[model samples]
Target: MSHFESCWNPASPQALQRRAALLERIAALRALEDRAAAASARSQAVFDKRGQLLPRQRVALLLDPGRPWLPLATLAGYGQDTPELARSVPGGGMIAGIGWVSGVRCMVVASDSGIEAGAIQPMGLEKILRAQEIALQNKLPFLHLVESAGANLMRYRVEGFVHGGSLFRNLARLSAAGVPVITVQHGSGTAGGAYMPGLSDVVIMVRGRSRAFLAGPPLLQAATGEIATEEELGGAEMHTQVSGLGEHLAEDDREALALAREVVAQLGWAPPEAPPAFAEPRYPADDLLGLMSDDLRQPVDMRELMLRLVDGSELLQFKPLYGAATVCAQARIEGRPVGLISNNGPIDVAGANKATHFIQWMCQLGHPLIYLQNTTGFMVGKDSEQGGMIKHGSKMIQAVSNATVPQITLQCGASFGAGNYGMCGRGYAPRFLFSWPNARTAVMGGEQAARTMQIVAEAALARKGLAPDPVRAQAQFEQTVALFESQADAFHTSGLLLDDGVIDPRDSRAVLAQCLALCADAEARRLRPLSFGVARM
Candidate 1:
C-alpha cells in the first residue's frame, strides 16, 4: 500500500495529459495505415472479380522474381496545378518502369485501373510517352499491360482539347527504330485512341477480361443504331474471332503474364545485331520423323509442337485466340529469337487480317520469321465473304512477300491454296522451305483434287462407252503419293531449292536453330512501306 501511494503521487496533471496525447496520436497513425491497407485490398478485389490482375502482380509474374522494379514516374501526375488530379489518378493509371524479365532488363508499362478507370488522361499520356521515349533511347524491349478505357473524356473536356497525333508519332518513330513492342490486354481497350496496343508487334488478351474495339457499346449504338453486348461487341472471343483486332487470348491474367514473359524470353536482350543462341541440350538429338502422321486433315495442336521445339519452354505465342486458324508466336531455338507463324486450319477473315498485321509488325521489328504451314485455306461462307476475306488474305500475302527477315518455312501437313502463300510458300521464296515427309503441298487438299479427277475420269469413261468403275475411277485419282511427291521433287529440282531437305517434325527446333545461327550475321533489310498508320495503343 505504501509503494502504490508513492507511485500515484509522482505523476503531475501536465505530464499525464502529455502521455494521453501521445497515445492518441499513435492510435490515429495506426488507423490511417489500416485505411490505406483496406483501400489496397479493395482495389485488389476489383481486379480479382474481373479475373484480371493488378499492375504490381503482373510485373511480379512476368518479370524475374526478386528483381527490383525501378519505376520511371511514381509521381507522374503531381504537377503544380494538378495536385488533386494526381491524388485521384495516382501514377496516371500506369505503373511504368525498367524491370528484369527472366534477367532481361526491359521497359514495362502496367496499367492500373484503380485510378481514373485506367483512362488515358493528359498526364497519363505524357507519362507513357516519356516511358516509350526512354525505352527507345535505351534500346530496350517495351512490354505494355494495356487496360485503358481509351482517352479520358472528362480530362479532355477540362483541357479544351486532346490530341493523339503526338503519341502516335512517337510510337511510329520507336517502331521505325526497331524496338520490339509487346502488349497484353488486361481489360477493356476501346475507342479511336485505343489503337496503340493494336499497333504493337504482339498483342495477347486475357479471355473474359480483355476486349479491344473501336468504340464501346453505347458509342456503337449511338453511331450505327447497333445494340450489342460487350462480349458480342469486343470481348476476347469477338476480337480474336470476329474483329481481327486481338492477336492472342489467354485463359486468365496469370497465363497472360506468363505468355508475356515467354515473349520476352523469345526476344532475349536486344541490339538486333546478333540473335540469341539456344541452349544446346534443348535440341532434339534424333531425327523427328516419328512425330509426323499421314492423316492430312487431322488437326495437330501446333502449340504443343512449338513448346516441344523451343528451348526452355519459351514459346511466346501472339494472337492465339483472334486468328483461331493461324498461329503466331515468338520463340527461341537454341537461344535465337524467331517469329513463328503457323496455320490453325480455317479461320475467318478477321483472323487473316490480324495475322497480316502481326507478320508486318514482326518484319518491321527486324525479327526473323518461321512459318509452320498446315492450313486448308482461308475461311469461306457468307460470313467470310462479308468479312472481306479476299482483302485481308491479300494483305497477309503482301506482308509475307514484303518481309525482309530471314524467312524459313516448315510444311508440317497440308499447305493448300492461298494459305500456302500466306505461310511463305515456294512463291515467297523463304530462305529455306523444308517439309516433313507427311506434308501435302498443292492448290487444294487431296479430297478436292480427287473430286475434280473423278469428274474428268467419269466424262472420259462415258465417252469411251465403258462404265466408270467408281472404285477404279477413284483409284486412278489416287495420285496422292505421286502428285505430291512430284510436287516436292519439282520444288527441289527447279533449283528453286524447296528445302535444305525433308526434316523430322521433332527436329524442327534443331534445324531452325542451326539455320538461325547461320543467318544471324545476315544484314537486316527493310521491308517496303506496308502500313500508312502509325502503331498506336
Candidate 2:
C-alpha cells in the first residue's frame, strides 16, 4: 500500500482564511438548526405541565445511550413555512434520523408536537416519507414517536393531501416486508393520522394522553349530531381495550418510551458484529477544514483530502497517468474497502472514460464507491467536443446510474452541470448524499451562467442589427449572478431537500463510516416477506 504524504500547511495565511470562512459557514448551518430546536423547545413549559417529555427528549430516552445518532433533514422546510428565510424555522415540525434502540439499528421519527401541535409543516410529509423509505430500503425496523394534529387543514394544499396517503401506504409496506413498523402514540393522532398506529405491526400508546380518532368531537358533532367525550371516541384506553388498535398502553411519556425500547429489544435482531481493528488516518482530520478554499473555482489537491479520510492514509492510485484530473483510488474507510473518485479539474474525455471504467470495475469487485464531487463539469471546447466529450460523459453517467454497489456522495465543493449527474448526485439516488458547508450546487457557477446569457443576448442583438445597451446588460448580468449564486448556497439547497443534510467537514469521516456500515448491514441481512401487512384486527 502506498502511503499518501501530506504537503498541506495549516499555518499558512491562506489556509487560516479558508478555515475561518468554512467555520463561519458551519456556524451558520448550526445556528439555523439551533433555531429549529429552540422553536420546539419553546413549548417545554406546556410539555412539563402535561407531564410529557419534549420531542427530542423522547428520542433520547428511546435511543441507546452513547450510540451515534445521525440526524437527517435538519433543514427540511426552511423558508417554506413563510417567505422570509430569517423568520422561518426549519425541520418541518419533525425530528427524524437513524439511531440504535435496544441494540437494534432502527429509523426513528418523532413529531415535534411542541411546534404548532406538530401539524405537518410544508415539507413534514415528505420528511416522514423519506424516513420510511430509508427504513424500508435498509431493512431497518421503523420506529415512530407519534403525536400530530395531522395535516394543516387551514393551510392545506390539494397536492399535499394527495401525497400524504403515501405515508400510510409506506407503513403497510414496511410491515409486509417483515421490517417491524412500531409506533408509540404519545399524544394525538387525528383524522387520517389514526392509520399511523392502525398500520403499524406494534403500537404502544400512553393512556390518558394518547388519542387517535377519525373525527374529534367538533367534526363528529357537525357531521352527525353525536355527543361523546374524547375518551369515548379514541383515547388510548379505548384503543387498547375496545378498538384493538393499540397493543401496549403506558400511563405516561416515560413509560411509553420504556415500552417502545422493550419492544425493540424483543425483535430478535442479532447484535451487529464488532468492527475489525483499523488504523486511523495519518493526517489530522482537522486539516479538512482548511485544505480547500471557500471558492470552488480555485483548484486544490483532492488526494490530500482523501488522505485525511481513508484508513491509515494509504491509497493505491488507479490509472494515475491516464486521466490525472479525475482521481480514482482504492482505499479503506474505517476498515471497509471503498473506491474513491474525485475531481481535480473539469473532466476531459480521458477522465470521463477513466471514471466510467473505474465505476464498472468497482461494481464488479462489490466495493462501495465514494464520490467527492468538486467539478465545474466535463471539459467544454471545440477540441474536447470533437473528441467525444458527450459520448464519454454519457458513458460515465450510465455507469453511475447502473452501479450495483452502494454509492455515497459528498458535495465537498462545486457540483455543477452534467458533472452532478455523472458523479451520482441526488437525482441518481446514491445510498446517501451529504454536503459540506462550503459546497455549492448549481447548473453552473453564477459567473459562468451570467456570461453565457450575456453572450447569447449579444448574438441575438447582432442578428437584429442592433447595438447592445451596455448599462442595461451589466445590470441584467449582476441580477442573473445574484439569483444563481443565492440559490447555490449549501443551506438553500439543503433546506429544499436537494441533499440529505449539510454536515461539518470535520464530521465527514465518521458520517461516511456510519453510512457505509448501514449499507453493509443491509446487504448482509435477510428478511421475510408477506403479501399484505398485518392488520389491527
Candidate 3:
C-alpha cells in the first residue's frame, strides 16, 4: 500500500460553492427525517397518558448505548403519501436500521407507531420487507418492535394486503435458517400484524399495552358474533399464560424493551471478528461535504473522495493511466481488506474492461468490492460503438453479477443505464447499497431522455411523410423532462426502494466502515441449520 497525498483544496471557490450546495441538501434531508420524528412526537401526549415510550425512545432503549445505528429508507414514501412535499412524511412511518443490542448486531425494525397510530402505509410494508431481506442475506438476527394499527384500511392497496404475507413467511424462513427472530409487542398488533410476534422465535409483550389478536373486538364481533374485550382476547398476560403465544410479559414499554434487549443478550450469537490493523484516512472526513458537486457532468475527482475513505488514505491503484475514467484500487476500510471501483466520468470501453478485470480479481482475492458510483453511464456514439463499448460493458456487468464477493454500492452522484449495472446498482443485488443526498438515478438524465423521445417522435413522423408538430412535441418533451428529473432525485429513488437509504455525505466514512465491518463478520460467522425452525413453547 502506498500513501495517497491529498490534492483536495477545501478553501477553493469551487469547494466553497460545493460545500454550500451540499449543506443545503443535507439540511433538506435532515428536515425530512425530522418531519417523521415530529409526526411521531405529536402523539406524545396520548402515549404519555397510556404510560408508554415513543417508538424512537423504544429503539434507543433497545440498542446498546453509543453504538451506531444506520437508518435505512428514511425517505421512503416521500412523494407517495401526498403531492405536496411539505405535507409528506417520509420513512414510510417506520424506523429501521442495523444497530447493536446486547452485543449482537441485529436488524431492528421498529414500527413508527406514533404516526397515524402506526397504520401500515403503502411503502412501510416494503420498508420492513427490505429490512427482513437484509437480515436474511447478512445472517443477522431479526428484531421487530411491534405496535402497529395494522394496514390502513382507508388507504389500503390490495397489493399490499396480498404481499404482506411475505413478512411472516420471512420470519419463519429466518428462524429456519438459524437466524433468531425476536419481537416486542409494545401495543396493538391486530389482524395480519399479529403474525410478527407469532412467527418470531422470541416474543416479549407489554402486559397492558401489548395486544396481538387476529381480530379486534369490532371485527371479532362482526365475524363470529363473539363479544370479548381485547385483554381477554389476546392481552400479553393471556397470551403468555393461556394461549402459549408470548414467552415473556412486561409491565410497560420500557420493561418490554429491556426484556427484548435481555433476550438479545442471551442469544449467544457470534460477535464481529477483530479487524486488521489500520490507520485513519489522511483527509478530513468533514471535507467530504465540499468534495462532491451536485452537477454530474462537472468532473469531480473520485480519488479524492476515496482518499478520505480508506485507511491512512492509502490506495494501490490497479490501472492508473489505462481506463482512467473508471478508477479501481486495493485499499482497507476500517481495517477490512476490500477493492474499490469508482468513476470520475462515464465508463468507456477500456474503463469497463478494466473494471471487469478488477471485480474478478477482487473475488479471487476473497475481498469485498465497494463501488463509488458517480457516472452518467457508459459512453455512447460512433467512436464508442466502434471501440466495443457494448461488449466490454457486458463483461463488467457479468463480473458484477457473478463476482461471488460482497459488493456494496454508494450512489454518490449520477447512476444511469448499463453504467448502474456495471457499477453494481440495486438491480444487481449488491450486498448493500446506499446513496448520498444529492445522488441522482434514472434510466437516463431528464434532458437526455426527453431528447431521445423527441428524436424518436420526429423520426416516426418523417417515416409517415409528415412534419413533426413543434408545439405538441415541445409539450411532450417538457413533461418527460419534468417526470424524469423528479423521479430520479434521491428521495424518489429511495422511496421506491432503489437504494438502502439516502445518507449525509459527512457520515459516509463511518457508515462505510460499519457496513464493511459487518460484511466481514458475516462472512466469518457460521450458523447451525436445522430441519425446522425453532418454535415457541
Candidate 4:
C-alpha cells in the first residue's frame, strides 16, 4: 500500500486517537443538549398541568414582551459536591432575575419544581435574598412565585444548623423596603419560612391548587390537639376566609396569573400613575343619584354601586372572599385608576379581614383611593375580637394613613361612627369629598338616634306622673327633624363638607374622573425611593 493509503487506515494509533477524541467531544455536546431539552420539557410539563407560566413566563407577562431577563446568578448552584442538595438547589428551585414586566422593570423569583420538589435550600434562600436586595436597591417591584415544600429536608441537618435565620431576615428586609412585593402561591407552601408569602403586599392563591401556612396539618396536630386537613389548615379558602393570609383567590392558575398581570399593570414598577383626568360624565343624571338608598338603615350592596360607577367592567375586586363586608378593589373611573373601599353592610368577620387586606394592598400599590361609604360599622362580638380584628383593623387604618396616594370620599349612604373614619371620612381629607343627598353621616343610624331620644323621653315621663304616650312621642320625634339635619350640617360644615354638595350618582363617575385627572400630573412627580427594612412574617 502507498504511504497516503496507510495514513488513512483506522488501525493507526494517531488516527485512532483523533477519532476517539472527536467522538468523545460529540458525546459531551449531545449530553449537554439533552440536559437542556430535559429541563425545557420539565418546565413545559409544569405549565401544561397547572396552566401556570413559570417564573420566566410570569416575567415575560409582566415585563415588556421582548425584554431579556438578566439572571442574577445563572450558575448559582452548579459546582457543589452534594449533587442533589447543592448544585441544583438554587438555580433549579428558584429562578430569579431582574426583568421587565410590561414595560415596567422588576425583580422576580420563580419556583422550579423539577429540582428537589421546589424546596428552598440555603443556596436557594441566598439567591432569593440577593434578588430582593437588587429590587430594593433599584426601586423595582419584587414578584415571587412561591411553590415549595418550605425548606429542603435533605439539607436540614447541614443547613438548618447554620443559615436558618438568614432567609427570614432577607424576607423582612424586602418587606421593610416597601418594594411592593407580589407573591403568587403556585403550589404547596408551608412551615414558618413559607409564610413569607403572607408578608407580601398582594398574596394570590390558585383556587384549588396553591396553599400556604405556618405549619402543615400534621405539624399543627403534633404541636396542639387541633387536627385539620391540608385545605382546612392552609388552603385558599382558609387563608382567604379564616386567617386572611391570601389577599386574592383566583379561579385557576390562568386567572391568578391574569390578576397578577392586571395588578402589576395598574401598579407600574415605580411610583403609581396619577388619577386620570375626568372624561366627560358617563352616567346619566338619573343614574348619578340613584345609587343612594332612601332608608339609611337598609343595607345596600356597595359592589353593585361601584360596578355601575366604574368605567367598563374594569373593577378588579381584591380579597373578595375574605372581607365580604368591606369591599376593596381597584377600578377605573373614566379610564382613570382608583382604589375603591366600600362597605358590604352585612358580612362576617372573615369578610372584614379580607377588606382590611385589600385596602392595605391598595395603599401599598400607591393607587388613588375612593371610599364608597355605607357601613353600620365593623363586625362586633367576642368571635371578631378573638380573630384579631382590632389589630387587622389598625393595620388597615395605618395603610390608609401611610398611603401617599390621593383619596376621594363618596358618601353613598350610612356613614356611621368609626366606619366613616376608617373609610376615609372628611377627617382624612380626601382631595374632594362629596355625598349623595340621601347620605346620613352620624355616630349611629337615624333610627338608633330616634330610639335613644325616645328612651330619654320615656325616662322623663317616668319621673313625672304620666305614662309615655307612643302617639305623642312619635309626633315629637318627627318634629325634631332638626336632629337629623344637624348631622348633615356637621358632616358638611363642621369639616365633613356636608355642603360639599350632594353629587348625582350618575355624575359621580364624571366627578371621580375629573378628580383623578386633576391629581394625575402631581402624582407623576412623586418618585418612589428605595426603602428596604426587615418585615414581620
- In order of appearance, the predictions have TM-scores of 0.44, 0.99, 0.97, 0.43
lDDT of 2 at 32: 95
Candidate 1 wrongly placed segments (more than 4 Å):
1-41, 79-89, 158-161, 268-537
The regions of model 2 sitting more than 4 angstroms off are none
Per-residue alpha-carbon lDDT of model 1 for 278-319, expressed as tens digits?
Answer: 454332433133333355565656664565666665566676
lDDT per residue for candidate 2 within 360-403, as digits (tens), equals 99999999999999998889999999999999999999999999
Each model's Cα RMSD: 30.9, 1.0, 1.4, 30.2
lDDT of 2 at 113: 95
Choose the strongest candidate by TM-score. 2
Ranking by lDDT: 2, 3, 1, 4
Please give the TM-score that candidate 2 achieves against the real structure: 0.99
Which residue pairs collide in model 2, if any? none
Candidate 3: stretches off by over 4 Å: 469-472
Better of 1 and 4 by lDDT: 1
Q: Is candidate 3 or candidate 4 better by lDDT?
A: 3
